[model samples]
Target: MNYLETENNTKITHFVLVGVSGQPHLQIILFMLGLVMYLITVIGNTLIIVVIILDSRLHTPMYFFLSNLSLLDICGSTTTAPQSLINCLQDYPIISYNACYAEMGISLCLGVTECFLLSVMAYDRFVAISSPLRYMVIMNKAVCLGLTGISWTIAFLTSVIPMLVTPVNFCGHNVVNHFACEMQAVLKLVCSDTSTSLVLLFVGSIFTLVIPFSFIIISYLRIVVAVLNIRSTEGRLKAFSTCGSHLTVVTIYYGTLIYMYVKPQTRESEDKDKIISIFYGSVTPMLNPLIYTLRNKDVKGALRKIAGKSKA
Candidate 1:
């Protein structure tokens, strides 16, 4: 039975997910990998949030932002991971039009928020290093909340506003060359003129990715200058250590994104980029907790404190 209500041009009621590939072996491997990534992301991010909340010693602005980052990672991975996993197991798994757009909007919102959050974190670090005594006063509760709230608001506006202004006109049974409604895959299926949407996307990318990335770079440069002025070698090491995790994360995240975004995506590129997309979208989230906690004495101390209390 044909479910689609067609006009002269067949209206796209749904989309088909092309998992990593049509081959059964590849599909199985992709499903296993995606599922593992989703589980790891959920578990790692949740643990970070739990530790941050329970440990009073971690009640600083840096940890506070870290908690929010964990939350965003959890939500961002969830926005598409489950559906992608299901599509890997099912042949040509279909998603309704509304559901696909909803996924895109939610994920895009989270991505934009993360960009702003990372920039905010870089600023936080700069302030801490550059003005240690006044750090708390500068990054007070009100300021933290205000910055976080603004990031979410900007994210929401950026993700939804342009979409409302210029909606994509998709053709029938759009076989999205992806396991989820990735922006590129969805864009490929648009039946109408997309010059306007492309232009809007370019403008949006400038603000969402390029601008924030520039801010982070500038913030870190100042941080580097501040750290170099420290009289004590130990103080310099401590300052660099404080920033090491964030810098590592920033490099991996931005490197993958810049490479992915700049390349001209083709049919083959869509399939080829699945792992790259998954690496940024899921693997990074999973790695964040490990990155932030593994070598950090503060997080280790907090975990030990919690463990000791639980034992008692």
Candidate 2:
């Protein structure tokens, strides 16, 4: 590996991020847009975290998971967006090799963690809606903590293992076409054999995407069946209302993610690909907290109360 940095070293030491679109005229526009987005994402997610912390009313399992998810989104978007915002205004955005790897690794960890966390939250909803009698027992403190712990562990392992498989020293091209250090984009820059690494990526995809997707599907199916069995129409309405926000968020989050990853990488146009990446990496995080809070009356009321107290 030292040879990768020696007198004979021809391998690239850093990568240039092509970063979104490049119209000299659009740079200022993009920088302003990204700055607004980054601020909204940070502040919105921060409010969610703070709400969950400051309000004893939000200490429920659902809010507990939501606070964790909010924190992850803040970290996730910040890892990619701030740099992209700066790069949008600059002539070049250069990322050192080690920094690239670290960014890629951490982004993967948080991204995958969020995926599984959403699925886990979906399950929590399933338990609450389908088995109200047993909900507390099922999602007790120990169980919630255990699930959170496992999600983080799986996320770290999924990220680190794929990173380990990718060669740190590649012989040629060092520019990442995308704004951020996604595994797919970085691995495309690898000069060494990536067939094995791609296969492992597929495996990681199964653990990160497939397994969580399966859990979400099964949980929802059962919840639907359970809801239908309720004798009163009001009971069913109430049940669905509880799940409505989560279902909407899951649809948005997973739908964008699927568009980003599941498509044939070979066929996507650069601009189209960047658009999809932006939705997942930059836009969705900004929207998630708002979606959860605005669509739910309880959260809205809580926020109003918090605001009122502050003003008072």
Candidate 3:
């Protein structure tokens, strides 16, 4: 159905996106609710980015990585949330092929970049825990910049190749099922043979999921071992606490992602796919800043200082 709708120069120029729930009674409430969530997600991630940028004290490798993660959360939320809010409110959520392609491209890039960056952060924690004495030397400014740059570069390159292989052909039904032009949703609309698309998605998953998951596991294993070696209970507690919040967030993000893409692609039940997509996309980004701030004293202290300074 989507393929025929996407055939070359198909009749539809703008695609409709039917959001998760369709009850008229629920739409208004969901719209308002999504708006609030979207706002909170933006504000929370933005504050983290601002705090890291303005405080020279946070200019170290740790905060640099944190800033990148916050930025990713902001970009990630923005890619999905506003459109979702609009879809919940409006009679129709329409998107053009060009716009859909752009959204899918950027979302894929940012999403993949975040997965790698989180893995890099785990390694940072591992080094800090396993070899605290040399943490500063190991994760110097040069190394920090290199890791961040490479993460973004890899993400862009991976997403771009798939898009290049499959140009936007609009010869089908224009309405995208979900709010955003996610890779799967977009691919489902393609008129061309999507084997290349599937292959590219497979390679992307290897980078975004497999490699990163392995790194995260290895880093945490080393960290757990190092923490266990600490004779003092206080020392062990502190060491584990540092990465606990991150581990929670990563588990949530990756768990849903694995469920979505790690298996063979089957036709989705609308409600089921919508709920799952919300987990990885909308809800996760909304939770990131809270998770980091609650777990890290430094961020809490920074927020307190910012609040105090504002009053003065």
Best by lDDT: 1
Per-candidate local distance difference test: 0.83, 0.79, 0.78
Candidate 3 C-alpha lDDT tens digits along 90-209 = 766777756666777778788889899999999999988888899999999899999999999888887766665554454554556676676666556655566766776776787689
| lDDT of each residue in 233-274, candidate 2, tens digit only | 988987787777677777767777776665544422365666
Model 3 worst lDDT run, 10 consecutive residues: 1-10
Collision count for each candidate, in order: 0, 0, 10
Question: Which candidate has the top score in TM-score?
Answer: 1
Q: Model 3 — TM-score against the truth?
A: 0.91
RMSD to native, candidate 1: 2.6
* Stretches of candidate 1 exceeding 4 Å from the true structure: 1-9, 262-269
Runs in model 2 deviating more than 4 A are 1-8, 264-269
Q: What is the TM-score of each candidate against the true structure?
A: 0.94, 0.91, 0.91
